[model samples]
Target chain A: MRVIFNEEMRAVADDLDTMAQDVRRAINLSCTALLKSDVEAAQSVIDGDSAIDNLESSILDQCVKLLAKQNPVATDLRVVVSTMRLASTFERMGDLARHLAEAARRTYPQSAITPDAMPLFTQMGDFLTVMADRMVSMLADRDAKTAEQIILSDDQLDALHHKTFDLVLADDWTGSRQDLINVVLLARFMERLGDHAVSAARRVVYIVSGFDPTKEPSRDEGTDID
Target chain B: MRVIFNEEMRAVADDLDTMAQDVRRAINLSCTALLKSDVEAAQSVIDGDSAIDNLESSILDQCVKLLAKQNPVATDLRVVVSTMRLASTFERMGDLARHLAEAARRTYPQSAITPDAMPLFTQMGDFLTVMADRMVSMLADRDAKTAEQIILSDDQLDALHHKTFDLVLADDWTGSRQDLINVVLLARFMERLGDHAVSAARRVVYIVSGFDPTKEPSRDEGTDID
Candidate 1:
């Protein structure tokens, strides 16, 4: 009985892990579609989102099924429930990536502004790519420290976002304001994607640490600064 | 054993239903604060949101605990999982409403647009308020028909959104373009709130029907009959 129970538990974990992998792939595919200006790839990501959603649903269903069937204890239950939430976050991440891809498709073949704007966007894209990779790694490792790091990384993304706005609104922008607005919206989407990833990373920290920052601490003590 | 089990299940359901009620109130409070320019009410909503988040986490914890201890199956699992997701949507609704409140506070006294422009903004507010109320009712009743009705109602919100843009870009507009732009962004937020509510309604329908519309039915299969 114990052997069978252990095997079933492993199966559920493996299923969730595989779903996470699929989410990572979907994010990469969406980003690649954006960078290469590939409409087909963009459409593929949009169309393929349904599959990712289905997978998320399936993983949650399985986790619930296991909990109902096995009556997993405290830690196990937390892990499963946390994964369920994590899966939803990953699904939203895929949606954000797809939105970016679509935006790229819409504004393709014509540069809205001078080539100077490209470098900042490229940097932002690089930041997102790193964030995505780190998010996946943190989820797999369940490393609370790494998860915390992801949240801090969002500050840098925020800086980039501010810079993006300044560049768009600068006097040198001779492009159509509407097109510039779309670019801002696209950058906003990417920034939000980073925020969601950070939020998810925070959730992972909560799962592993048994303390959610969303929960207020009972008491605050003053910290010493150098 | 059966008696004890049923009693525990009842307790869980009651807690979830109460939490949902609080969610409805929180969202309404935020919206009311926005429309009425009640800064105190808005602050109350903002301060109270932590309670909602806390409630959400504890409700989730309870769901996990119930699954581990009671091992609820079949419909019970669906009920818990559905409620969990619904709670999240409610939380986001509250967040969006809070944002609207902040926007109102930022644009206090509702700008000095002409009386004619005021009518259009009033109409936009009315449309959003009605949509929000309908959504609350749909969730409470779990009525798929009402959910579909609300989805159709979103088209009205979209129309109002366009009307807002038209009014802002009109030749008679003498106000600062930035103020009009701000109003446009606010209008967009209201439209998005409607979209989110409609989405929540759709999820309720899915929970009740166990139907995957994404897989089985074409979204526009019968819409062209008129």
Candidate 2:
């Protein structure tokens, strides 16, 4: 029985890894679509989101089964339940990526970010892609150092978000209202992507260290990002 | 054992109910602060948010303890785990309220919404207060009818959101870029508050009927509010 429970735990971890890979793909693809105004790539990212949804559901189903059958306790109980919580954040991360894709799709034939603002977004995509990759690695290894690095990188995303905000509200901003709105929303989406990664990492810290990190870092409240 | 487990489940439900009430209070206070530009009230709302966060953490801790000790199964297991999910949404709802207060406080000495656009926010707050009331009731009663009503009311909030968006981007919209940004974020916070309420209702629906509603309602995907 114990051996079967261990195997099922392993299976849950595998599902989460798959989910993370799909989200990483979505993030990179959606950001590229936004930057390039590629309608087809945007559509592909939008269409692929349902697959992430299905994976989250399957992972959650597995968690329920593990709890009901294996009756895992102590650290094992934390592992099973945190798997559910992690899947929730991963699922939300997918939705955030889709929001970025939708921005691209909605602006089809027109780039969402004006050329003057292009570099900021490119920087965001670059940093976020790195953050997404680290998030997945942390999931597998529970490396506290990796988790700290992810949080630090999120600060960079926030700085970019603020820069874009300042530009849009600047007197020199000659872009149309739609352009301003688009960039602000896009910036917000990127910042939130980082927040979700941090939230996932904080949950990992909780599971590994048995110390609740939820109260320590207000930024770690991914749910509050909405 | 079954009886004790049943008592613990009731307690979880009760904690969720308390959390919902706190969120409802936060919403009303924050909206009042925003409308009145009452920085003191806004500060109170911000200070009170930690209470909701603590409640969420405590509820989640209870869930983990129940899972480890009682070893719930089938519907019983679903009840415990879903309570954790419910707490998450409720905590987020409280955070959304805090965002509203932050909007009010950030713009102190000047209202976030212009007088010309103030009526719309008034209507949103009035309607949302009603919806929040119904959501709390549904959490306790698991009333399907109440859940449907909550979804319907959320549509009203969405319409207001779009109307405000159009006004902001209208060719004649003469408000400062700061006003436009403020209203947009405030509008989003209000819409997301409704979404969180609907999400909580859906989770309740899931708990009561075992019907997965995640796919049925796209709005409940809180990340999709963009």
Candidate 3:
């Protein structure tokens, strides 16, 4: 029974790694589509989101089965519960990628970010891509240090999000009302993506250190940036 | 042992009820703040969000303890897992309220919605407040019918959200760029509040019916609305 439980746990971990990879790919594809105005890439990201969603459900089912059959307790139980949460977080990250793609698709033949705001968005995309990759690694290794780094990197993403806001609201801004609306929503999608990544990292810290980092004051809460 | 487990489950349910009430109040207060430009109401919502968060943590701790001690299987297991998800959903609803309040506070002395857009937002707020109230009741009764109603109402919320987009992007829109940004973010926050409410409702449906409504096509997924 112990051997089977360990193997099943390994299988769950493998599934999570696969889900993380899919999310990373979705993020990268969506960012590329947004930056280059590639509708095909955007459409692909939109189409592929369901697979990520399916993976989350599969992971959840596995966790529920493990809890029912194995009766995992203490650290083992925490791992199962946290796995469910991590899967949900990754699923949401995939949705954010799809939202970015939708923005790109909606604005087809025209870039979502205006010329003046493109640099800020480009930086935001890069940060999110890196964050996604780090999250994948952190899940695999279960290293608290990597998780901490992902949390720190989210600060940079937040800064870029603020830059996008500033660019839209600046005195000399030349974007139309539609452009203003799109920029605000797009930046918010990217910022929320970063927030979910931070959340996933915190869960890792919780599972490893047995200290719930979520109990601490959440930096994203009640902030000026939604 | 069964009686003890039953009692503990009821405690979890009661805590969820409290959280839902807090979320409902937050929604009403934040909307009042936004529509009325009430800075103090906004501040109160912001200050009170931590209590909701604390309730969520408490509920999670309770659920985890139940899982470890009772070793609940089958329906009992689903109840515990679903309760955790529901608590997370309510916590997110509280955050959305705080976000709305922050929008109001940021634009204090002036309503977040421009005069022309006020009616639409007012209706949106009304729908969300009702949805929150129903969500609280649904959590208590675990009624699938009420859960379905919450899901349907979210469509109205989405329509209102799209209406806000149209209003902001219209050629006649005279609001400043800041106004446009605030309107978009605020509308998105409200729409997301509806979405979370729908999520909590679906979890209730899952618990009651043993048919995962989440497996069905997600209404919010891959849409033009971000």
For all candidates in order, the CA lDDT equals 0.64, 0.83, 0.87
Model 3, range B1-226, lDDT digits (tens) per residue? 8899999999999999999999999999999999999999999999999899899888989998999999899999999999999999888888889989988898888788799989998999899878988998888899899999998777788888888888987888898887888788888888888888888888999999998755877735324555
What is the CA-based DockQ of model 3? Answer: 0.66
Task: Score every model by TM-score.
Answer: 0.81, 0.96, 0.97
Error of 3 at B98 (Å): 0.4
In the range B1-226, model 1's lDDT, one tens digit per residue, is: 5566577656755665565566556556655665566677667766665666666667666666667777777766666776677667666666656566666566566642345556765776676666666666676676888878877787777777777667765677665534544555556556666666666666677767875333333221111100
- All DockQ scores: 0.28, 0.55, 0.66
Who is ahead in TM-score, 1 or 2?
2
Candidate number that wins on TM-score, 1 or 3:
3
lDDT of 2 at B11: 88
The regions of model 2 sitting more than 4 angstroms off are A217-225, B215-225
lDDT of 2 at B202: 79
Worst 10 residues of 3 chain B by lDDT: B217-226
lDDT of 1 by residue, A99-215 (tens): 666665665664432355677777777887787778778877788888888877787877877776677666776644355545555666667677677778877887798775456
Q: Candidate 1 at B96: error in angstroms?
A: 1.0
Writing each residue's lDDT as its tens digit, candidate 3 over A94-176 gives 88899899989989999987888888888888888788889889999998999999877776777777788778778899988
After superposition, which runs of candidate 3 have C-alpha atoms over 4 Å from their true positions? A219-222, B219-223
Worst 10 residues of 2 chain B by lDDT: B217-226
Interface RMSD values for all candidates: 10.5, 2.6, 1.8
